[model samples]
Target chain A: MNERLTYESLIAAKLEQLAPLPALADDIWARISADLDREMPTDESEAPSGGGPSLPGTGGMLWPGLGALLLAVAGLLYWYSQRSGIPVPAPSPQSVPADARPASSLPADTGSPKGIYQQPAAVARPVEAMPVPLADSAAAPSTGKLPPPVLPLPDDSRPQPAASASQEPPPGQPPATAGDKASPPPAIDTPIKKKPRGVTGISNNDYRIVPDKKDSARKKN
Target chain B: MNTPDEDIQLIIDGCIANSRKAQELLYRQFYGFAMTVAMRYSRDEMDAADILSHAFVKVFKSIQQYDAARGSFHAWLKRIVVNEGLDHIKARNRFDSPAELDQAEEVPVDHTVVEQMSAGDILQLVQKLPPATHAVFVMYAVEGYNHREIAERLNISEGTSKWHLSEARKTLQQLLQSHR
Candidate 1:
């Protein structure tokens, strides 16, 4: 019992040691407690009922505008398709005309303007006939001797040489005088020796060709 | 006696029903005691008042869970208020210096000296303690809790609670001694 008394005394001492807190203003308590009496709904089902009608009123106005926007997009797509000229359904080969088929499918010569084979044959015959006529014209000119096809006249507008001067030698040496013509100067008969294969005669060999051995010996002296 | 109990019961019931009048009465009746507990754990008068008001709101909201058989309504409410004050200190991340505990054993605190000090002066000294130590000290000394009860309330070890209390006592002794 004394221990319990001591304990109580200790508690009293501690409480005495503590400062009393300042009183809270009544307004603060009133605000806090006032919040407590306000209910918070636990689920949507318990949520206040009036909030949904306002939303659909705004939502209803949006639908027709969205539909008009969709129709405008579709119209734009159609106009684009027309402008680009894309065939909606492609034309098949079977739809083409028979006359448009190529000529290779016809009989070998039947569909050509003349016969298909005859056209090239006819064209080649004309080319062959053309060269024959050209050869005939050339032969006719030679055989007929047509005055050498009228020799063209020389257009000699410049001066001409005197006819007598063609026979005269040029004026540098004694004109082949009659005295030097005796026996035609022994024919000078210098036998030109044929050069041996691959060997050319030098200028000294010209003197060795003199027929008079005496003249050659005097030349050496 | 029955009238007071019935009156308290009516207020509790009215609070559960979300009645504003009963909530206001409840707040008024307990505000002083709760704020006193709050001031022991708070740094200043305004902080004590703020904590007390918040605790009353929690009490009114959770009044449906209050069991009269376990304790007096006021004591339960006071516990809620004390816990709210401790939470405020925690939320603010207030901590006392660990050096306060280094001289824990040697620091001399005479209970008689504490007894002689006015309640206001003691509360001021308590608020000067680091938050953890002040909280343990208020729970153990002022609120009449054992180390274990303080540990449970503060979610700390019993050893931690004792350490805080000892540290708190040392600091308080130093403060009070200096005042001498």
Candidate 2:
């Protein structure tokens, strides 16, 4: 009995008794025929140039615009190159002065003292000029030495005779150098210590300028 | 001078040649069969008509692909019409949820019960099932497809197809019992 209720029998019976579909189907067929007729080309010659029409903005026009953009970019690059100055070449090692070599180029000390004090004495001469007046003042310290005389020197010292120029002092002013004395001290006997101008890390006495080691030692303590 | 097969061949040949007269004749001749296929899958006359037209257009475009060696032209065209109608229903996405079948349990239907119900009543009741289940049931039962064939056509599993058909039968039985 369950087998008798098969899906096949039901469908077969339905197919046999199904109502006709003429009017609905005819309307459908008419519409399809009409649409096909409308869409089909009227003349073979008027059919689209190719099998199918292409999408807009995808063909010839796009290529030309892209090419023009590339040309414009290349032209801009050329213009920028022309307006800038020619590039200068970098200097080679041979072009640099001996003295101008970087500090790192100096030989390492390696704890040796051979050239440790090789800095020139001409660099130390300025220290002597500062102490000349101090020596004079110390000699007269008991009298509370008068303030050093301020005298303006002539700009044309090059033309003056050396001997007479050495003998004269500014009016009512004491000699700053011994040349103004009735009997000047022998030039060689004076011990002049020239302070090196522009050289830091040294005192006025021309000492070998060591760092303040005492302060660092106290900090450690 | 004309066997039915020869007559159908002549109509088909005319249609291939873009003969409007032959197309009109063919449309009239198959209108009943195509409409039955459409009506079974559609909700109303207008919808059925639209499905029929679309199916015919597809048939015209793909007529060259059809081989008489494979099956009868009517069978081939009927397959196309059914597919188009199913596609239309799917595009509309008008299936009911399967939750309604919760109360639908399978019953033992005897030959007497099957005999009492008309084909129209059974089809109407089949149509009332959820869309996915109804499609599977029609393709499997009415169209005489195996589970694998129905599964391939509908893009569902063979198990799913069997389940849908089972649920369809249960629902159909319940509807028939109520009608009685």
Candidate 3:
């Protein structure tokens, strides 16, 4: 009879008789509850219980450095796009040719004095500027390379009678072809003007700009 | 003393309400059972305590997801605690077993031998088995998991799970015979 003890029945019997547990340290729950208070409210769900789909937004544990890497990449893209766009230089008012004036650039609609494209004398005279891209020799402003073909401006931006607005490249017109004619060749001999000292006078005591320790050290190096 | 059902319900409600007193009561009631389970998975008592603490914290935090309709709360908690222990062993890379068990003869033992043993006395015998073999036996035989579930938990092939179970039974039979 003593030889009949199988492994399965023995395990079952032993597990049935519960073992005594030692008392936990007094400070255990106190530390656990304190840690829970800080970390639980924000993440009531992501406690890593078995057999469920994992939840998101554990910035430290789940993703580790992923959130920081994503933020850095986004910041770089924003800075690059903003920094790449240089402002188009406005042509001088006096230097513009009379033919370049927007009023004469497109053929005026003769059908109605009140034609939709007709701008009121006090309001938008360049209402007719919509159907046709404003075409004039000197009216369009050019920056650095043929600036990206200016999209047709909304009627709200009334054409300046003195300065020609930049024209959009016509269909079948590659930007490079139109750009070569419009772009003024660089004047290499043109003297570079030194930017004048701050136009507004300021006392040195107005503010202190302290360099960060690392930046200052790099500068000295 | 509260009836078992009433006590479980009260503890569930208390934990959901975030009452520290209720959590303490709940821990006191279940801690022994958890320790017994944890000790078998771990190498020693200190490691078992660490695993139990982590499992209990998870139990309290995830109490809201538990539905009594699914099964008894004790069964549900045991599953979580067992998985927690499995994960701890897996994290330390201690769960590997050889692909095959050499075919060994099964020793005959009297079923009455189990009636003579206390739970602590049996745990001592189990602790003597190699860690890998002990884990497989406890998971398959004691915990009532099938070979596939044990395979998944232990990160071994289904065949390997079966082989470990075989090795564990053989080793236990020999140990049991020696003690007799």
- Candidate number of the best lDDT: 3
Show where candidate 3 strays beyond 4 Å: A1-5, A25-38, A41-221, B1-7, B101-107, B110-113
Give the best candidate by DockQ.
Answer: 2
Candidate 1 per-residue lDDT, tens place, A89-114, comes to 21122221122212211222333342
Give the residue spans of candidate 2 off by over 4 A: A1-8, A41-221, B94-106
TM-score of each: 0.48, 0.49, 0.48
TM-score of chain B of 2: 0.84
Candidate 3: residue B161 lDDT (0-100): 67
Candidate 2 C-alpha lDDT tens digits along B1-180: 999888988888877776666777887888778878777776666877888888887876667677888999889989999899789867866444434322223455544555677766666676788878778767766776777786687666666666776777778777767776
**lDDT of candidate 2 at residue A187, scale 0 to 100:** 32
Better by DockQ, candidate 3 or 2? 2
lDDT of 1: 0.55
Question: Candidate 3, residues B1-180: lDDT per residue as tens digits?
Answer: 899898789888988877666777887777777777887777766677777778878888988998999998888888888988888777775655666543323455565776677777778777777777778777866777776787787878767766767677777777777777
How does residue A132 of candidate 3 score in lDDT?
26
Looking at candidate 1, what TM-score does chain B attain? 0.85
| lDDT per residue as tens, model 2, A47-138 | 34456775555555777888999999988866644433122222221222222222222322334443343322222222212234333333
lDDT preference between candidates 1 and 2, better one: 2
Choose the strongest candidate by TM-score: 2
Q: Which candidate, 1 or 3, would have the higher DockQ against the true structure?
A: 3
Minimal lDDT window, size 10, model 1 chain A: A146-155
RMSD of each: 40.0, 29.1, 23.8
